[model samples]
Target: MGIELITLLIVVALLGLMAFGVPLGITTLTVSLVTAILCFGERAGFFIVAANVSEVLHKYELIAVPFFVFMANVLERSGIAKSLFDSMAIAGGRFRGSVGVQTCIVAVLLAAMSGIMGGEIVMLGLIALPQMLRLGYDKKLSIGIICAAGALATLIPPSVVLIVYGLAAQVSITKLFAASAVPGLLLASLYITYILVRVRLRPGMAPIYDIPETGYPFFKRLKFLKGIILPAVLTFTVLGVIYSGIATVTEAAAIGAVGALVVAGVRKEACSSP
Candidate 1:
């Protein structure tokens, strides 16, 4: 009955806190601790808390988040994402609604690279949105492009959200990464198709401006293509290492971190070149 009543209080507290807009992280910590204390005696609860906290602190699966996040931060500030966008946008010259389509494409590609909204949105918002708007795209469509594309954070390989979700759910992060691939493509494809259809139907929504294509010559396009292809290989490398009965999640995470770091380093030098 003591445990039962404490459980009840914990639930009530969580509901009230959420109703009043308390941050979820804090709410979860507080309620979970309180419930543990209620379920076990104080001494037992203390040991359990210490043990669980230690386990979490020592976890290896979570390395993917920070490694990928660092890779993202490094890549974002270095301007690799912009190169990708510029290359694609120039290649798709003069096509109606191509900018919107490009957003989805770049977003997916960037998602695999960085997988963070802050980096993704700021870059896309600054670079792509202006071009789309200048081409007379609807503000709604432009906004949708940025937001929807940026949301690839949830589904893209190296996705930070999925990394976090894997840690919380105690699942193999690589499997989740692999599972998201098909769905991520599907979502991006849907967005692109919608844009093309909408532009075709209204023609007012996304007018094609006189796109001046200086085009990223073959070498440059090939260079930017590395940003897209390397991630795929690294993703498979990490996931392949896991599912092939070789490495554990921790081992795979280490591989991902090393791979992302190496890629970011190479890309950094390229972007820094005159």
Candidate 2:
């Protein structure tokens, strides 16, 4: 009991040092060594460290964390977001503030598939932000859209934060993913509503683009609907199985990732023809 009290004190001291600007690794090491010595006497302290290392090494499930990270990185480099964004913009150009809305929309979908913030920001910033700006949208609004979407890229599903928390708490990771969906959409809705309302109130903030002065054909509209719908169905299928007890989180993520690839391939094939 005395040793436990001493350990608690050492941890608090380390956190205080961090609050005062000490580096985390050094602070943690210094505090832990002192705690171990005080708790078990100096001689027994060495054995405790070897046990900690052994525990870390024994966590095989942890291998999934880095693989998921790498999968996200790879998906970004594969141009999947570009496909999704362009598909969304086929009709997104005609309506006022639609481009900004589409930007948020695509960012949410992309973040669902990939949780890499840097890639989300840079990709959308370069591709979507400039398009919004050149179309006569206000500078501040354009920058806000990009920055906000980027900042939020990691908070939603497939998030590294939730995964870490789930692992620590021994909570079900699939539930964590499901739990994030409601809030993710809520935040995204807030952003879209804000942008649309602001654009409406000011009128000068978001510019509307006319891809064609005339309305597009109904058949073309049907085709565009197919483009977005197919992928949505596929992703839903994968997630449904995972969250509904038909499959595990690992199994579901694998299925979802592959489903995305198949959908992307279909879209690319459809577009490649004359």
Candidate 3:
């Protein structure tokens, strides 16, 4: 068979196996092994697989992937989202449909902190959904806002997706993080604006009820800053270390991972207390 025909047949077989519900990794390996053996014999095929594995293992950048993932998981469990939503809810007060606005803001921050959509969406669903429903928010608007805002995690800095892309494309992860910052913030702003305008146009969709003042002294309200400062500092520390050339991407990721664990430890006692 011609080389082109053989290549096409292998690709078709790979897809057919996948379509038949075979695991993707197994199908890929099977197709590659069959093709390599046909083209260059078993010895060369084995060598090729070994070489690829060695090259991947030798890429030190991949080490950062696990650190970033660890950091994200730690932060996801830290109860930061509830605090963030509470603080932003105060900021959004007195504005029509401000609850939705605050939820979007919380989502933006969660995206930066988590860098993954699944956790952010889950957080929003668990925390914001009940609050929005209690405040008489429209079901459709609440669902739409949570889903759209949570998706920002994929585009924001510290995103695992960006890290993987940078490695695969042989590009700088720091540069990708830097480049995405403006666009991510811009998209988030647009989301908030859309919610505000929609809520204004259809006031019935997101009814505004008077929020009882906490009656606490002004200084007590400052506690709201607590929710924001730590996460913001962590985000800036990781990104700053990278952008300022103070550390490599992997080093920055390590710092972030350590920072996340510290935050989680500190919050654990407080979160568990009544």
Total backbone collisions, model 2: 0
> Ten-residue segment with the worst summed lDDT in candidate 3?
209-218
* Regions more than 4 Å wrong, model 3: 1-58, 214-220, 269-274
Better of 1 and 2 by lDDT: 1
Identify the leading candidate in terms of lDDT.
Answer: 3
Show model 2 residue runs off by greater than 4 Å.
1-61, 217-220, 264-274
Q: Can you write out model 1's per-residue Cα lDDT over 1-274, one digit (the tens) per residue?
A: 6768776787899999999999988898878777677778788887887798787767776665676667676656656667677767766556688789988888887776666766788888988999888878899989988998898778876677877788768887778977988999899899898989999999999887554342545554454354455556765786577668598655665676677677677877776799
The TM-score of predicted model 1 comes to 0.71
**Span of 10 residues, lowest total lDDT, candidate 1:** 212-221
Q: Is candidate 2 or candidate 3 better by TM-score?
A: 3
State the TM-score for model 2.
0.71
Clashing pairs in 3: none
Q: What is the number of backbone collisions in each predicted candidate, taken in the order shown?
A: 0, 0, 0
TM-scores, all candidates, are: 0.71, 0.71, 0.76
**Clashing pairs for predicted structure model 2, backbone only:** none
